[model samples]
Target chain A: MEGALMATEERSAKSDHADSSTGMLELRDIVKRFEKPGQGEILVLDEVDLDVEAGAFVSLLGPSGCGKTTLMNVISGLIEPDRGTMRRGGRDVSPDDLSLGYIFQEPRLLNWKTVRGNIEFALEARDVPEGEWDGRIDRYLDMVNLGDEHDNYPTRLSGGMKQRVSIARALAIEPEIMLMDEPFSSLDEITARDLREELLDIWKREEKTIVFVTHDINEAVFLSDYIYMMNTDGEMFARREVDIDRPRQYDDPDIAKREAELYREFHEHVVD
Target chain B: MDRLTRYLYTVASIIALLALWYVGGVTLPEVIPGLPETYAALVVVLTTPGPYGNMFYFHVWKTIEMLFASLFVSMIAGTVLGVALGRNETLESTLATWIYAWLAIPSLVIVFVSAIWIGFDASSGYFAIPLVITPFVGLNMWEGTRNLDTDLAEMAEFFGAGRIQTFKDVVVPQLAPFLFASFRSGLSIGWKITLLVEAFLLTRGVGFMFRRYFDQYDLPTMMSWLIIFVVFLIVVEYGVLAPLHERVMEWRPEAEGVRVTE
Candidate 1:
């Protein structure tokens, strides 16, 4: 696993240098507000800027209600920011133009659909070629280690299995950018740890840009190549690069050190 | 406690109620007919041909036809209109009061007014029955559609599902339980309203036969028809609606404690 991680890093480093453009996903001067009942408009996102390089795993780490999910929603085009411009592949693009996939905090699988049915639904919606559907569904399901659970309904699956199906569903679309909002927050620690490893493996193989939102410091440290620490007021307060070697263990000293440093940084930010 | 015990209890209760009714009728013949007399009267009605020729067959058929026709029309029209109202906030607000008013108005009044306008004919019953049932269905569907999972909806849209696709895949599945609830209730209410309309209009149905018996003072025959109609309703409720409900809700995890036994 360690050797494979090193090889992936070497390849990613070379590819990162090959692309000279700004980023695969670029947000400039993004602002958003919400209307409170008694109070007037409250600013949620204040002139936030972010750039995600192609095939990079980035985490937006913040406390609860820190607008991390809101930022994701804006990026996914589920909610439009009041003012902002988003660029993909160095060209201004709407959410509709980008082939985007989203894995919400909850496994929002259609209860009436089987695992295969859910994947097919996404494929159909994305207008994937009918001939390619079976191959894509089978391949992605196997990627998530759920090849045999194709006929099972969501209600029959455990929490971890359901989240895996969700991952498979998102990957089946072959999206350029995948927006995940705390996808594993609801799972038990053991299950979450396993999924995080599986996710890192998938990310290395798929080579897709992922913008993950979570409040867990260890999670952000474990998964991200770059962690953007967000303040409670929705501002990007700090950016840290995890220079440690990959195939990182949960109890690895380096990861624990980084996790402690992030915790301190978060507390200091709150104090500020 | 268990399935057999539950069935036994249900049977015991029914038998106890029948015993009480039989004793009451035998003691006070003026008010109620005994069980034996009612059964004899039912046999007579089943076998004998009235002025209309086989009153049981013809009238029962007409009632069933009207009941189902109204239910079918109301289900389609009500669902469409309800979905529209639920989706459009401005339209819902503008017409909410009118929907409430329609619900407030009695079915008897609607039947009478419809008969006055369209005349006391078979057509009037058909028209009035849909009008009576549509509002209930429409209102239930409106609430159901309004309360749909917006998160799922946003997810569908984010994944590039168009409006029609979202409605079919996300919206309709969530509304299934509500739709079935409305349908079952609407059917139950719809048949009763059909009978009332038929009675008032003196048209060709079980209601007309019931009215005919009332005028002739044939108490036993009238009671017999009532019993048969109630049995028919029970059959439709359990045999048709229950099975359909079970099928639609089969995806839901079974409740821990509930059990059904035949």
Candidate 2:
């Protein structure tokens, strides 16, 4: 644990991209609206405020129509929030400018490329020094426990294997802020559980800030340091902190207690 | 074992076709030449350097040359037009009807028009095949481009790939099966149109030789020549196309679909 913190300190010191002195990545009063053909305007993200510390895992916990995805999209620069400020260390830059890495809900892998080739595609897109590619790919895929399956194609893989590749692809970019939009939502329960554990492992080892989005309350409880609870009206209604220790057991009494506490709050705000 | 079973099934199919041909030869001896007679005539025709001092190799070479030249032009033009039509609504709406109309016009009529307009020349013959063949290739590509996986394209965009890289890396691979299918049909249709153009217009080609054998009503020689031509197509199919297909789509998992037909 001390070693991971030391690495995070060294990483933040070495890279001038993100400054944590002013509370790191900040999103304040973000507003976005979409116009339907019949409807005049539909407000998706309404003046949302979020502050992410450097090298922390934050999840937006919400139900299906809660604008978690739209906020994620805003962070990734896929769409701009109409009236808001998103700044990295007081600079008017969105999250993507800092070599943003994204993992979609689907694997979204190129079916033609091999497992190794998929990572290579990301590496090329990032223009990471070509010399560093093989090393990064090897380390990330090894971290994801996909070392032996580099030559396999996506179709040949199971759902879990493909999601692992997606994780490896996202991490291979070495982004300062990694955005995941319900990445493990479609997987079976057992697979999702295993991947959540593995994701936490990678998160600790890499020490990169992650903004994960999911509708699963337990998923947010298990994975995040800070869970921003959101409701169906495009508002982040509440926030909670999970203070569980690392390498958390599945049936830890403290985790279940925290989940039980959040469950009531989740129902009151989100499901209602 | 899969390869062996696949080859065995194909061999069985070929034997069944040959048995039917033999029955037809026995039943209609005057019209259909049996394998024995066709083989005999094939030996005679292949051994003789030329038919009546005109070299068969020259005609064969001309037909092949014309086939390649026209197919090259059509494949490029067709794929470009097809992809363009697919990517844009205005282009698709304007040209799709004209392309179908072109496809409906007979290859014979196209050749006649080319002969009358351009005069009987080698250039005219080369130019005529694309006119007949491009529409079919374009239609194949149009359908493929329309069904292209836009999800993959979006993924490419999220990865920060440029337009060129996305088209080359993502779009091209998805459209490859359609491109290859168009190529195969283009080769088949291109050669037939080449024969039509050569027979009516050019002085030397396999199509002219076919016209002669057709005039004489020499069923055995005609069948021999046809069998040899089909052998070339078989060599291309197995030697070139099948291997390329395996390499390109090696990522696809082999599985049978559930029965949908009643």
Candidate 3:
């Protein structure tokens, strides 16, 4: 438990020294609205204000249809909010300049590519130069502990392996900001539990800024440094800063109780 | 029954057909000649190597050459045009009416029209074959390219992939399985249409031989050459196209180790 806090502290200090510009991603007054020509306007998000600090793990928690996805998409530039200012590296940058890393709920792997081929594909697309490819591909696969299944195709992999490959592929590019949208929501419970631990370990190791979106309160409590809980009306109702030391066991009641309490707090906002 | 039993049933059916031919030759004595006559004629023509004997090989070879030439030309032209149409929505929608008009024209009509313009020569089938098959290949491949998984392309974009890299890594690989499937159907249709054109308009190939044999009422010789043509087509289907389809689509999970239509 103490070890994770120490690692986070060391990472913060190291980033403070390395270059303050590398880890900061900020969003300001983001609003996303949708409308049909014959129908009325639909406001998906309204004046959502949030700050993701350098190398901090944050989770956006809410019920279904609460616009956590819209917020993430706006940050990732998949959807353009009606009105907002997004800043990264202390300057207002477009989605292109933000260098966002995204992991969708499904693996979305190219069926034709082998596991290693899939990882190498991102490098090839980014033009990471042929010479550096061998090392970078191997290193990322090793991080996900998928080094052995590098030659297998996606069809041959289990659900868990496919998701791990996805994580490895996302991390390989070394993006300054990682955006995950309910990435583990579809997995078996046991696999999801294992992946959450693996994810935190990887997050600690990489020290990259992560903005994770999930509806699972326990998952948010267990994995996040700060929880930004949103109501169904697209408003950030509460921000819970969990000071629980990490590398804690999943079966611990203290963590479970906190997760339950957070869920109850968020549940009050849901109406009939 | 299993596949082996089904295969044996096909072979047994062929043997039964041959037996019926022999019996009908003896009993009816009025209809087509027996299997022995055609079989004997086949051996004679194969071994003699006369102008007539050698004509079969030449015509077969010429038909294959014309079929391949048209295939090569159409593949390159179709891929370029298909990609363009697929990527551009307005172009696809605008040209769709004309494309359908072209497709609706029959192969025989197209060859007859070409004969009027080109004056019934060896080159007639070559041009006619491409015209007949181009739209088919182009339309199928256009759909294939359009149906490509856009999510993978977005992944490519996230990795800073340029247009060419995204096409090569994401778009092209997905398109390959579809393209091969289209080609399997296209090539067979193209081969058949090329032979029909050769028979109807051209003067120097298997089609010509078939016409000559028909005029002479030499049923044995005509049937022998028809048998040879059928065998050649089977070889092309199994030996050429099936392998090509399997090789190109080897990456697809459903395509792996299992033959299409097996």
**DockQ winner:** 1
> Per-residue lDDT for B126-166 in model 2, tens only?
77898888998899989989998876776777788887888
TM per prediction: 0.90, 0.88, 0.86
Q: Candidate 3: fnat, from 0 to 1?
A: 0.50
**Native interface contact recovery, model 2:** 0.42
Pairs clashing in candidate 3? none
Off by over 4 Å in 2: A1-23, A37-40, A269-272, B5-20, B50-54, B256-262
Question: In model 2, what are the clashing residue pairs, if there are any?
Answer: none
Model 1, span A177-242: residue lDDT tens: 889999999999998989999998999888788999999999999898878777777677676777
- DockQ of each two-chain model: 0.40, 0.28, 0.32
Q: Residue-pair clashes per candidate, as listed?
A: 0, 0, 0
Q: Choose 1 or 2, whichever is better by DockQ.
A: 1
Model 3 docking grade: acceptable
Please state the Cα-based DockQ of model 3 relative to the true two-chain complex: 0.32
Residue B149, model 3: lDDT of: 76
Candidate 2 lDDT tens digits, A1-272: 11111011112321343456544777888988988789888888867887677778889988897789889888887887898898876788755566678899899999899999999988887778999999999999999998988887888788888888998998898887789999999989998888988888778878778999998877888888778877776776666778888778878888889989988877765553
What range of 10 consecutive residues in model 2 chain B has the weakest lDDT sum? B253-262
lDDT (tens digit, per residue) of candidate 3 on A17-46: 334556466677788877848767767676
| Local lDDT at A119 for model 3 | 79
